[model samples]
Target: MQFRYLGRSGLKISEITYGNWLTHGSQVENDIATQCVRAALDAGITTFDTADAYANTKAETVLGDALAGERRESLEIFTKVYFPTGPAGPNDSGLSRKHILESINGSLTRLKTDYVDLYQAHRYDFETPLEETMQAFADVVRQGKALYIGVSEWTAEQLREAHALAVDLGVQLISNQPQYSMLWRVIEPEVVPTSKELGIGQIVWSPIAQGVLTGKYAPGQPLPEGSRATDEKGGADMISRFMNDRVLTAVQELKPVASDLGLSMAQLAVAWVLQNDNVSAAIIGASKPEQVHDNAGASGVKLDADVLKRIDEALGDLPESDASQTRSPQGRPS
Candidate 1:
C-alpha cells in the first residue's frame, strides 16, 4: 500500500484505508469483522476510520476488539464525534464543550486506545460556537487524548475558520473528511480547492457513491439480497435515487474503462478519486474480507488523462447542492 501525508501534517496514512460504517457492528459479526480487519492489515492498510454514531457506538468497540493484543501499534486509528451516542438530551450531542470532552473520553474507552491518531468532528455544529469547539479540540490535543484533529462535512468557510483557529492556538487541524466520488462531485468545486489552498488533506469517504459506481444495481433490478438497500436500515431511499436509469447507464459506460484497465468497477471508482493529489486517503467500507482485499487492489490502478476525461463525460454534471439537508440515507460528505 502507498502511504501519503494526511493533509500538511507530519502524519502519513495509507492511500487505501479501512472504514467501519454500516458494516462493523451492523452487518458484520465478530468473526467477520476480525477477518475483515486482518485482511486489511495484511494488505498494508494502516488507517482505520470509525465514528461514535456508527452502529450506535458498537462499531468502535468491535474495531477496538479486533485491534487488541500486539496489533494496536501497527495501525493508525481515527474516529469522529458530534453525533448523539445516547439519549438526545442536552449535552448528548453537538460540538459543545461538554459534549466534546465527554465524547472524547467515551470514544477513547470504546476504541481501547488512550489517544486517537485523528479525532474529527463529524459535522458542523451550528448550535455551538466555533471558538468553543476549536478550543475544546485544542485542549484534547494538548492533553494527549487525540494526536490530531479534523472536521467532516464542513463548508469551505467553516474549514477555513477551524484551520485559522488551530493555527492561532498552536494546534494542528490536519485533514478534512468529505464524500467525493463519480456519482457525487459536489466537493470538487469548493471543499477540494479550499482544502488544497489551506494545506489540508482530504480523506474522502464513500468514494464509490455507496456502491452506485460499482455497476451492481442496474435499472429496474430488485435490491440484491443482503445489500444495504434490502436491509432494514435507512439506505433504501438513497438506493432508490441511485437506481435511476441515467445513473445505471453511466455506470455501465464505465464498465468498459475498468475492463480495459484490468480492474473491477469498484477499484476503478476508488482509483479515480485518489487521482487527485489533494486526496490524502480514501476510506472504504467492507462487510467481508474479500471486499477489503478487492478495495486494496485499487492502489495499483491509475486513471490517466484520457480515462479521466471519459469518466467525466460519462458522469456529466452532478448536483452541487447539499444532500444532507434532505435527509439523504447514504453517509453525507465527511
Candidate 2:
C-alpha cells in the first residue's frame, strides 16, 4: 500500500486507513471485526483509525485486541476524543481540559497502548475556550500520551484558530478528519485550502458517501437486506440521505465509467477522493473482510481526466461543494 505523510508532519500513514466506526463491538461481533482487521493487514494496510466514542468505547478495545501481536512501531493507530463516553455527565464530552486529559488515559487504557499516533478532536467544540482545548492537546503531546494532534469536521475559521494556537503551543496539529466523498464536497471550497496553507492534510472519511457510491442501492429498489441502512446498529441515518432516487440513479450512472476504468464502483469512489492532493488518507470502515480487500485496491490507482469528467457529468447537481454550507456540528459529535 502507498503511504503519505500526514500534512507536513514526519509521520507516514497508509493511503487507505482501516477504520471501525459502527461495525466493531456493535454491528459486527468481535471475531468478525478481528477478521476485517486481519484482512486490512493482509492487504498491506498499516494505518487503523477508531474513536473513543464509537460503540461507547468498545471499538477501541476490539481494534486493540485485533492488533495485539503486530509490531506497534509499524502501524499508525489513530483515535479521536469528543462526544460522550461512559455516563452522560456534563464533563463527559467536548474538548474541555478535563475531558481531553481524562479521555486520553481512558483511551490508552482501553486500547492497551501507551500512546496513539495521532489524537483528534472528533468535532469543533465551540463551547470550550480554544486556548484550553489547544493547550490540553499540547500537554497530551508533551506527556507522550499522543504523538500528534488533529480535529475533525471543524469549519475553516475554527481550523485557523486551532492551527494558530497549535503553532503557538509548539504542537503539530497534523490532520483533519472530515466527512468527504464523491458527493460530499463540502470541504473542497475552503477547508482543503485552509488546511493546506496551515500545513495540515485531510484524512477524509465516508469516501463512499456512506456506501451510496457503490451503486448497490439501486433506484426504485428496496434497501439492500442486511445493509447498513437496514441495520440499526450500523450507520443507518448517515446513509439515509443518499437513499433517494435522484442520488441513487446518478450513482448508478457511474458504473459504466468504473467498467471502462477496470474498477468497481467502490474503487472509483475511493480513487475520486484520493485525486485531491490535499487528502493524505481516506478512512474506510468495513464489516466484512472482503470489503476491506476491495477498498485496498484503490490505494495506488489513478483515474484519467476523461473518467473524472464522466464522473462529474454523472453526478451532475448532487455534489455539495459550497463552503458556506459547512457548519460546526450542532453540539453533537456524529
Best by lDDT: 2
Cα error, residue 263 of model 1, in Å, equals 0.2
C-alpha RMSD for every candidate: 3.0, 1.2
Per-residue lDDT tens digits of candidate 2, residues 222-333? 8888788887765788888778999999998998998888988899899899999999999998989999999999999998888889889998999988887776666754
lDDT of 1 at 287: 82
lDDT by residue for model 1 over 162-252, one digit each (tens)?
Answer: 9999999999998988888877766777777888888889899988878888888777777678876776665565556666787887788
Model 1 CA lDDT for position 204: 94
lDDT of each: 0.85, 0.91
